[model samples]
Target: MTQSATRSGAPERVGRFELLVPIGTGGMATVYLARTRLIADTYRYAALKILHQKLAADDGAGLADLVAEAKLASAIRHPNVVPVLSVEEDEPWVALVMEYIEGETISGLIRAARAKGERIPQPIVGAMIADVLAGLHAAHEATDGGKRLDLVHRDVSPQNVIVGLDGRSRLTDFGIAKIDRTNATATGLVKGKTGYMAPEQIAGLKLTRAVDIWASAVVTWELLAGERLFHGEPMPTMLRIVNEIPARLRTIEPSIPESVDEAVAQALAHDPSKRPATADAFRKILVDAWGNLADPAEVGRYVQALSGEKLDRRRAQTEEILDLRARMTTVTRHAEASARDTSSSKKAPGDLPTRLESGPTTAPGETGFASTGSLRRPGRTRALGLGIAALGVVAFGVWMVTRSGANVAASPTTPAREASSSEAASRIVVFSSKRPIVAVRVAGRTVESPPALTLGVPVPTGAHEAEVVAADGERASVSVPADASQVLVPLEPATSAIEPSASAGAAASARPTGRAPGRLQPPAKATAAPKDPGLAPPPY
Candidate 1:
């Protein structure tokens, strides 16, 4: 596999995914453009959302939520919903691998149109929202073992809806979704955007599928009206959602048909009972009101027209990664075959070592290498031949390293001896840390490190203080041993004060990065009931 460099120089490999570039970052995770090689000459592109190391280390809750999102999203198999392919947990990193959608988000489309002093066409908005409602209907009615899931997508803002270049809209990011099987959000702790939340939801009342309907309607309203349905700071937004009625779509955008305006108004009613009972019901009303919907092909063309340049750049980057992967695979295969052939030729006749009985090859979804059992043959000749073959392979490895212009130590696995003051500065010191490091500073130089399982930083052999920085902003320093070639530094766990909620607000307010499929908001404090009922602390 190949590795890419982030700005922090983190090695971008999580499980089998080779992260190409980061598409989006939120409070809990960063979504990357990644791919997995199924076999030689075959690969599958995916959006790999990796939980931040600090968040994953904070507690088990973050990991559990990631698992829940995978399970919930995977259960609903529909065209309008993005699919989760797999979930991977590799120590400090937990990731959700999903089918990569190549297109603009609805939020992005809105921003582009606004920049040009335009609005999304009424028919296009109707068609896109219809598809989103279809996806939500599937999620709401999904089942497990023939039992109803009672799923509610708690977060369904424009940022969470992606319109692929194929002209299809797909709903995604079930991070804050509620399902009957999992108590994802506790009582009193509100989750989701303040503006899109239903009156009942903001009041911390019981939530149902109707909440998604309210959010969907808000998105539809913004698309047609070219303005936020509820715009203000968090507290005020919540107040407006709970205490005020929204202006009709036709009132703001005169071109909007009266029927479409009425349908959206019904869905945005203050009381759940007053709104459409289900997403399907609301979608039906919208379709009937609009009468004619934009074709998928037509929607795709519009998306391309607005985002053609950016899409082309992303497409070029993907091609470069695929090409690099192919080249690396060819080189690795050639090296392995060369080593095997050279070792085999050095063995004498009838002196072959014990043959390993082959077992099942690495299966799909399995990580790492396969294991085999060796059938031992009782003979000193076999042992001697094996020793010779091992020496030959080692020699070949050294030769290869030398040919690549790298210094070869006496032993491949051992570090080189520290160089004396009189000796040339050919000796190297390797620095490692217990935690994933972001960067290392030694000998008046700072080197960006990877977020890999094990970190190793090499510098010219010397006595110096090395400072290391972890992803969570934890820092530690170690004094390098003058005569040693390796040093291990330990960093204490992150302080409890580094709350995930601290950055949640900023993440929520920031524009959608790339094709991220979710809106991450701060965990809302459970508001005191009108009757003053006490509640537990908000879940960070």
Candidate 2:
């Protein structure tokens, strides 16, 4: 909750992580879209979950629980499990920096589908639940010093499962997970979403991994039926879960097969022993029932169809945040240079260093350089102005060199050695889109596009095809010679693909009109799919 302010008034950067924007505020912590200072000119984004000061102060054990969550998640490594990259134990706050899943939660997806007058397809639901079970099993099997940690994810609600565009479902948020020999969940205290809680869990009985199994079944039931399995206030819902007889899956939806219904019924059994022995067992049954229809590619296609426009906008916003990082660096360097110059100036003996309040003021929308009238002293002010002007000139030159259609060639009289070096240099291809957000493909492979791109990248000295695809599936492709380093990609508004036989009106009418819903202040670079940091890495 504390802001980092250097003497120079630069944007806050916590340790090596630069906080971009606040994306969420929850009961336990505030999540930020943040990036690491990996190396010079290289950064990776992550979700920075910082514990609220009030929560830490009010409940001393709350902070420990958050740290325990990070440690526990770090121990369980699996593709389906969201990873914790690092932890920060600094003053005024403690943070759990984790791999940010660049996708919507299952709850978000379900809401979107409902809004579209669509039910989540059964196969997709099966695949998603299967993924969650797989992750839970990994955690359950996690061991420390050759002894099983006996982990049980107490919270397995729709909100904790993220469905990536690649059709992968990742389980996140282990804050309330129960670990053996630890008072993480406490014996009698109830935790987790009411509708997803197991019957045993509501009774405050000693828990086992079966609680997670029951919760998963509840999620499956909800997904298949398109309604909560249990409803009403917390007490009413808990009572219903304990007393009322559960409905058969087929009763909610007739299309659901009997085998699937039987499997879910067993998973949602009142007694923990009656439930499936393990998460893997439940997953196998669901996978078999769903069959080949639960293909990842199909699920991926469904997700892309629903979220393409939002993803495009998200990628653009990510680029802008990265761009801001560079600007922040520039401002920091400029401030330091001004400070140094002020310090080294000829001054009276025993005088204090000249203190410049607010450092330098920048013109509206202009970064890196400052406007006139920042410093009061004539000589020092002129020097600062000159330095800023020189930076401006360099920036202008860079812009000109990177602009689309700009060409530069070696002189015919250039030395042979220099010519070889130029040939060896990696050719860059800058992909530009006329539309604010468009996906660009190079050689049929998806690539990240920069925001407000002007410079074109150099390509291998041969002919290459560049494709610009809109969120609506409208695409345009162009061929360019390898020798031509820079090319402008004109991306028009998504229109119907022209078919040789069908009329343009027919094509237009066939196209989907559903635009992916806009975000309510979403994260730009929520890092997921990060390289596994070993059991121990340097804490932030």
Candidate 3:
């Protein structure tokens, strides 16, 4: 993984898509949050991602690896792994549209915790590690035709993890990792975070499931120890990892048990076989070790010895306020992994798991679709989503039949073209924000837009309500009609809704202590209903 070069070509509208804002920049490409242009009458919201022109042109940009990661990750269904919502291959820059994670990194969380002179509780840390393992376990166990996929998380560290205020822990960034079943590493070059790298990994030895176990152990120690355990300072960190022994947990905190110290020391063992047999095993051990001591401050003298105040979402990480949005962003289930139909009839391949069940599976000229079997025709089956070509043909045919059957009584010669355009222009106009909004629809198709929002997308005509998803991975939809003009939607990390009550405290406070600027309102008096602050479209 060499540092990616600058992109070529100027930023310009590729077609009807509108680029929203720069989401982030990595060693390889600049990620932008964008929107797809909606039908002229239906201003529906859609997200589009573009590979930086320069990155797109690079032979080493590894398009195959990028697509492979998408395909692999798209198959797994763990809550922590961000899902790949869409993929567009043939383009100037191959764009991998995905369920964007809007939150900050675990590293950011650690930095915040340290600033507060408090450390994440051992149980929370253990749980966070467990979340990552659960994701890995799902990926590792994923099988295609009885063959185990045999996955390995090459990079497992705080930087790749995101812990949200909602108490959900997620594992992101699978692009750079490798799976034992499929060779995914970049040859002749090293990847993964230093200091967290296991002894075997540092020796340039081939990695296995054990490698991840070691990294997990190191991360667990970091969260519990409150400082870098391998080597605290500069170059020495990597050096001491190879030469010197790490300070024992008991030395740092006398209250620490012999088992906890031995467990960590054993996990850092030079031999992979000596480490915990699996991530699950390590998690169990730590969970037992942290039984009642989840919160360090509740413990003895060690708690007071810590300088910084124990803080949480509110005051621990001011720099991560923006990062919190990414972590807390909502999730959209549009790409629902289709479950096998419980019918007695013969089923199709899609009737089983593993197939990517996303978007409109309908054939040409259809409005609704069935997951299994062939496309159901107009009078036979209900399919959702048809292409413009087919819809146009149907529209033209319907117009012809209507014209032929119209009454002979006609009005005097008048400029009918101007009258039609004028009338259409005067119709109701509706729009929504980057966050999810529900719109009423008469049919699956959109009719005239309502006059609610001046920006965002207009709900397609004809439907009373449909789910609208944002790139950030959050989802919300309106069941009511667009005629309502404005909607009160719950939105977050990915634009989503904040429950009327989150945890025991948020219900009492009524305000997200760390929501984006003006994005949240102080919760009103005790009420069970979620508050909807007429949100303007996001400026992204």
Better by lDDT, candidate 2 or 1: 1
> How well does candidate 1 match the true structure in TM-score terms?
0.62
Error of 3 at 65 (Å): 1.9
lDDT of 3 by residue, 331-444 (tens): 111111111111222335444333333444566457554444443333112122323333444345433322321111111111123223323222122222323222222223
Model 1 per-residue lDDT tens digits across residues 1-540: 111211122234678877665555565676777777888957778898877555666667778788989999999999999999999766556789998988888988997788678988888888899999999999999999999889899899998998987899999999889944443344344778777889988877788999999999999999998999998898888888888889998878888889999999999998899999999999999999999999999999989887664454445334433433444345445546655655554545676565655545665457564544435444544456666665565456544532321211121212345434543352344343333344455664444322311223345644666666554555666666455443444543333212111111232233222331221112222211121123221111
What TM-score does each of the candidates earn? Answer: 0.62, 0.61, 0.49
In order, what is each prediction's RMSD in angstroms?
18.4, 18.2, 20.8
What local lDDT score does residue 191 receive in model 2, on the 0 to 100 scale?
Answer: 75
Candidate 3 wrongly placed segments (more than 4 Å): 1-19, 30-53, 179-188, 230-238, 254-258, 292-540
lDDT of 2 by residue, 260-369 (tens): 99999999889889888999988998888777556778888888777655454445434434443344345446646665665565355555546544555677667756
Question: Positional deviation of 202 in candidate 1, in angstroms?
Answer: 0.7
Better of 2 and 3 by lDDT: 2
Ranking of all candidate structures by their TM-score, best first: 1, 2, 3
Candidate ordering by lDDT (highest first): 1, 2, 3
List the global CA lDDT of all models: 0.66, 0.63, 0.47
